[model samples]
Target: MQTVNLGILAHVDAGKTSLTERLLHSTGVIDQLGSVDAGTTQTDTGEIERRRGITIRSAVTSFALRDRQVNLLDTPGHSDFVAEVERALGVLDAAILVLSAVEGVQPHSRRIMRILRSLRLPTLIFVNKIDRVGARTDELVADVRRLLTPAVAPLGTVHAPGTSGAAFRLYDPRSGGDANRLAEALAEHDDRLLAALVDDLPPDPSHLDEALRAQATAGQVHPLLFGSALSGAGVAELLDSIAALLPTSPSAEPEPRARVFAVERDAAGERVAYLRGYGGQFRTRQRVVAYRREPDGRFTATRGRITRLDLVGAAVDQAGPPGRAHGPTALTAGHIARVTGLTGVRLGDQLGSPAGLDGRSYFPAPTLELVVRPRDPARTLALHAALLDIADADPFLRTRVAPDGGTSVLLYGEVQREVLTATLAEVYGIETECGPGRLVHVERPTGVGAALEIIGHGFFGTVGFRVEPGTGVDYRLDVELGSLPLSFHKAIEAATRAALDQGRHGWPVTDIRVTLTHSGYWSPITTAGHFRDLAPYVLMQALAEAGTRVFEPCRRFEAEVPTDRLGPVTSYLVRLGARIDGTDQIASGWRIGGLLPVRVEPEAQRRLPDLSSGEALWSSAPGGDRPMSGDPPSRPRTDGNPFDRTEYLRFLAQPRNRS
Candidate 1:
């Protein structure tokens, strides 16, 4: 049987989990449907998810659709859990973007659509909750086209959509304006299909189906389907479309290569690495090399064996346990499963192959920082260990230990802070107090700068670098091949990355290009470690000369408030340094959107509730970095003159000094 990995994504309360349950039941995977409200859904297995009625983790389950095995990944809808969604996106073959029929398109929906487009993942849109009163499929379709893409083609139309048991007209190429438009769109992509249509020879159903599948897989077209996951309306038709339209997993290579997309702890506290086998097969007890590229352009590897393998949602009989094996067990390509005994495996790590898969930043840098202290200081080590586990699961939860032995965590927003606190208390039995939130900032080189350094203290080597602004958030490094041996390239790259991690202001540096313009090495005394140590000195000197620019995180925000309070809200937003993009009248009242510093977001949340009489809906997400608006604050530069050999040597002697 063929395999298809499908991801179900949506904003919160858009019935994403309910759709998963409906899909499972409609395909005979389960006898009865589970309820998200009742906390009985198969994918929402976590206690926190059950109580909150929201998915916090990405969960997987499988069922049979026709002759194909479909693996469904139900991801969290809340923006705070977007990191979870990013992890799942790397492994998905296709996606179903769920939208609420009554609410239309939302802010996060547009953000997710941009990500999906960037990944070039084929997608189908499902306007769910057609059973709800005031649900308008036509308006919702228009909203999707306006906000997301104009390439969307509706597969069906609804009749009396807001009523119970509404009727649907599934698209058939033989009739209707919608069907004709779909054909024309499909023909635009295929010359033969267009010629056939022009010759008065309508393409056969098989031909049209093949063309549709080809176009959809290439992301040239997106099919739109309307339904209510709660009532199971139009679900079977959706399934048929998926089975017929989406491409199956391609054949595996002779040598297996798999990407580990996620790592989690099972009930037994054993590390479980969830991987998608891109090629070949994985057998029990087979030794495999797990490797990942470090930021410094070095590949780190460890050897391990898969002690066990289990399908994600295998069923159980009266005599056997869940996820039982019926026969010889070996995970083949085009399958998703968990393996045990792979230690030191990180997210985005590749196994049993040297595919040179580069790591990708799925989410933006976290902006909120909080100092955490355990109630009992003695439990500090325990708190650290527990946080490590959480950080492993969500890479965005960056943790740092300060010089004073204080622990600080970088987060996306307040909700994540609350969730982390609750999870620590419940899972690890550790009580912790958190300090007030602060905004995290990053620094970048403003202009061209250069530096050259000669090692003197029993170390014989010289390194030089030219630094300049880089494109986007990339930290790019290039070496002159003639200046150094090929073997030393990795070391140089790694050292440069380490140097970039700390700017003069003690923040990570971004969007900088460093080129190794010159290098000289002498004998056995000169080693990679010497180069690593010498790198920071030259890089920091160059950064100081170039001058660093500090950037604060900004967010694009949208809020709907009563018309009577529009003036006050607009003035309040402006006072918070928000650049109002536009204001429009809506059914609820007035909708305003603008960009503002994330530092003021909490204040807006606190004040808006009272200002709007609790009738406001607001949303915001990271909107990239911008230079500080006013004159750049005077921050202390590196102490002493970097060009002074004596002073530089003394600075290097200090153990805590980056050099």
Candidate 2:
């Protein structure tokens, strides 16, 4: 039996957790079903998730199938918790992207597809909530093809059109009628399958399965499964599709490249990594070597014990060996193990699989930043340490301790800000005061600029360089070495990275190119720290020559509202400084699509629901750069009470200039 690692992802409140509960129930992993509204669901055991009625983080569960083990990860569908989903995809063998049959395609739904496509992950779409009245699976299926994929094909009809609360029967085009439709669709992906249909030769099950998996992973033949999570109709067949078609964990990998998707502190005050093994065998209590940092900021290889390994099914078991793990396991794909006393293991740390490769892609940069300060100034150091720990546990949550003195915690949204506040007050027992959280943005050179040259008189050394827009966002860098050996070019890149980190606006510079268009390294007499000391000054001096402009956060948004509300919606958009791109009538209402600036608080995406009387649907492409209006909006800083007038003013004074 093969083992598979799969993830369930959808927009917020799309019944992912409900579907997860049903999947577990049908698999016999649980004696009874659990409900998210009741807060009794297994995967949503996190206190934060239960209290908020939204998945603040991700959870894993596993069960058996046909003697095979399948591990399932349920990820938060909200755009704010995207970091968690991204990490999950890094380790997943396949993904089941959920869509609401009643609600149909959404902004976040498209965003998730883009992300999965980037990773080249095999995908299956489940059009859920089919049991609800007035759900149109046909139109929804059409939208999926138009918006997300031309390759999406309906698996089989579950709920009859215009019907609700009816018993669902699985369809197979291999049989007859609707099955023939599915067979015809399947034939488009494979010539042999088409030949089988023409010659009256029935296609074998394995051939269909293999073709679907290959095409799906290769961005073809997106299979859609319709189901009702509330009533559990069509769930069994959905499970069958996942079991029969999804690739299993440890399948098609040369060696293990495990990534730490989530991290939590054990009762003992040490960190434990939630690891997903992609291509290698894993054993409990085994020692693994990883690149980590020491207290003095030195990078070195450290050894750590696995401590315990959990294979999720029914209840998590401490499996001693790979062979002992369950096959066709349920919703969880990775193992949870406790480790302690290792100096530098971090949240996104890539651990070795006995094959020696460790480095992997780093997590995306944070999009929101706020200064975290303890109410009692005495706990400042403690607060600093705690934030560092959080950052260590989640690479995306970057924290920087300014040399001039202040600690800023980076996040993605208000939800993360709230979680940090709760964690600090409840978990750490520290009453913390947080500064106003603000949007995180990046800057790019609009025009070419030259690096400045300064001749060293004593403490100062002569250096020259140039900064310009780079070819791509991934490589916006600053180069400052006057001349370097081919072997030292990497070191120069490292030095430029150190400098690019904190631009004039104190944010990472992106999409901007820098060349030591010319530069002079410090003489032998100067200390090695000379590069560190001179790099910033040289960068700052170059800033004067090249000039600066701010880039504001922009979003691509889709807003749905009632047809009658179009006029009022346009009025609201005008007030919010948004420009419209197009408008169309959707199943529920009118959808206005366009780009909007991030500073437009009470943002249209957040307001459309209320504006439409809870009838509007909204979502945005996570983040991008746009034109800044010279004055950024002023919002209240909520880390503390809203009455802190001084804090409000300080937040208002934050640079409107993007970094």
In terms of lDDT, the best-performing candidate is: 1
lDDT of 2 by residue, 233-282 (tens): 88888888777666655443665555566777766766666766554555
Q: Worst ten-residue run, lDDT, model 1? A: 633-642
| lDDT of every predicted structure (CA atoms) | 0.80, 0.66
| TM-score of every candidate relative to the true structure | 0.83, 0.77
RMSD to the native, candidate 1? 4.9
Weakest lDDT window of 10 consecutive positions for candidate 2: 635-644
State the TM-score for model 1.
0.83
